[model samples]
Target: MPILEVTKITKQFGGLTANHNISMHVDEGSITAVIGPNGAGKTTFFNMITGVYQPTSGDIKLNGESLLKLKPDEVAKKGVSRTFQNIRLFGEMSVIENVLIGMHTHLKTNLFGIFLNLPATKKEEIEAEKEAYRLLKYFGLESLLNEKACNLSYGAQRKLEIARALATKPKLILLDEPAAGMNPKETKELTEIIKRMGEEFNVSILLIEHDMKLVMEISEHIIVLDHGEKIAEGNPKAIRTNPKVIEAYLGSAAIH
Candidate 1:
């Protein structure tokens, strides 16, 4: 069975329909790219799936179980995690601390236990720190663990956001514009890292990226959306030649 499934999901904001009967599936341990022009509802669809907004109609499933009614935190607890298009990090916090915060969902410490310095709380905190360091090391950010988040370069900041998301130990991760601010070299590195995440960590990924070269290089499957609807779904080779996809990009004067 697919790891993630969206079945005829729709979302409306006021009278404007942001997503329209969208359906897709992401296989286990694969990278799936969602591409579209601006105002095509790609981000809106992502928001709905991740619980930033509830679907006005239809359902989403992870591992064949319904995720439609769950709140954002509940959805996250179910092993779904995501990084935003804009980097969202505590600027003043150390890189390691920012990652440790992501592990909060997995920590079992209560307020009383934390205040009393209970053994369980201490153990959990230690484990969280270890896990955060491991993630930073994986992303080549171990050397910057003590640096403030805002002090890192733009590319490093993006990687830090991804590291924080991975700290959650999610079975599936959704990345919105992971290569948005990256230079050519940085984008190339990100492509390799994404591939490694699937191959080594055994995690499935769903990404929305405007970088066609990066998407074509990394994605195992690709879905194209236009104006709140799916226009095409296939592998990179097929998507590139898809008339609908070409038309969608060219019509809107949006280059891939």
Candidate 2:
């Protein structure tokens, strides 16, 4: 079953079409990837899916319900969560606090309850803190739970962003260039972590990445976009050998 579906969605900024009629689907509990060179409308596509930008045409659905009219926060509440291409963490906040913020959309306690320190509110707060700690531990950051996000190493910060996204318990999570600044060792570890995340976190994964090694090794399906249009899509082997994908994004040497 598809957890998310985008049908011929397009985005226009005046006369500029950042995304042409593009369509794709991500199966529940699978890891899929969107790949292309810079300016291929990849980020624009992500924006549309996450409700950062509304599509000029076509529909986006989650669990078969249309998300076309929803704003970013609304979409998030509907079980969609995402990480930006550039890491967007709360640098001034403690690592654990950052993860707690991601849980806000689904938090059960009302502000009034919290303000009054009701028993239910206190119970919810404790559970939220426990969940946040578990997420931090999953990323091996439990030891640094109280450290400022800005004080963490670059790779740790990347993992923290993903941990926070998982905090939402999303049905679908989109990662934009999650490996952008990682060294080989960190990327390798991330590949294994991503491979297990669907099962461990119970969420489907859709990602935009330039790392072919990571994409090929972990993605069950791949979509290639170039110049604002989809050029090819297939499983790892088919995508690796596709001429259009090779020419447009992967280059001729992609076949191995």
Candidate 3:
């Protein structure tokens, strides 16, 4: 069964319908990409899935359980995590500190236990730090752990945001335009990291990215949306050549 399933979901804001009967699925341990033009409602679809916005009509299921009623934090606790199109980091906090905050949902300590710094709570805290450090290391941000988030370079900040999301230990990670601002080298690095994440972490990746190179390179399956409607779904080779896909977003230059 697919790890994340969005079934006939639609959203409207007053008079405008943002998404219309959009349905797609991300299988376990796979890399999937949702691509489209600027106003194609890709982000809106993601918002519905991550609980940033509840679907106006239809159900979203994670592992077969309905997530329509869950709040954003509740969705995170259910093993769904995401990074925004715009980097949302604690600018004043250290890199590791930001990642540690993501672990708040998984922390077992109660208010009383935390206030007293109980031995058990302390032990869990230590482990959480180790896990955060490991994630930083994986992203090659270990050396900057103590550095303030705002002090890091743009690319590093992007990686840090992803690290924070990974700290949540999610079964599925939604990346909104992860390569939105990066040089060719940084985009290349991100492609490898995203592929490794799915293979090594056993986490499913669902991303909305306009970087055709990264999307084509890493996505195992592709979903193309146009004006809030799904236009195509297939592997990269097929999507690259589908006439509708070409006309909607990826122009003739996309294939060559």
Against the reference, the lDDT scores of all candidates come to: 0.90, 0.93, 0.92
Would you list the rank order by TM-score, best first?
3, 2, 1
Cα displacement (Å) at residue 247, model 1: 1.0
List the pairs of residues colliding in candidate 3: none
**Which stretches of candidate 1 lie above 4 Å from their native place?**
251-256
Question: What is the per-residue lDDT of model 3 for residues 1-256, given as tens digits with 9 covering 90 to 100?
Answer: 6999888999999999999998889998899999998999999999999888989998899999999988999999999999999999999999999999999988897889999999999999899999999999999999999999999999999999999999999999999999988988989898899989987777999999998888989998999999999999999999998999889864768633
What number of clashing residue pairs does each candidate have, in the order they appear? Answer: 0, 0, 0
The reply for model 3, stretches above 4 Å from the true place, is none
Tens digit of per-residue lDDT, candidate 1, span 1-256: 5999899998888999988999999998889999998889999988887888889999999999898878999999998999999999999999999998998888888899989999888998888888888889888999999999999999999999999998888989999999998999999988889989976666899999999888988898999999899989999889887889889888533433
Measured with C-alpha atoms, the lDDT of residue 214 in candidate 3 is 89
TM-score per model over all chains: 0.95, 0.97, 0.97
Winner on lDDT (1 vs 2): 2
Descending-lDDT candidate ranking: 2, 3, 1
TM-score of 2: 0.97
What's the true lDDT of residue 94 in model 3? Answer: 99
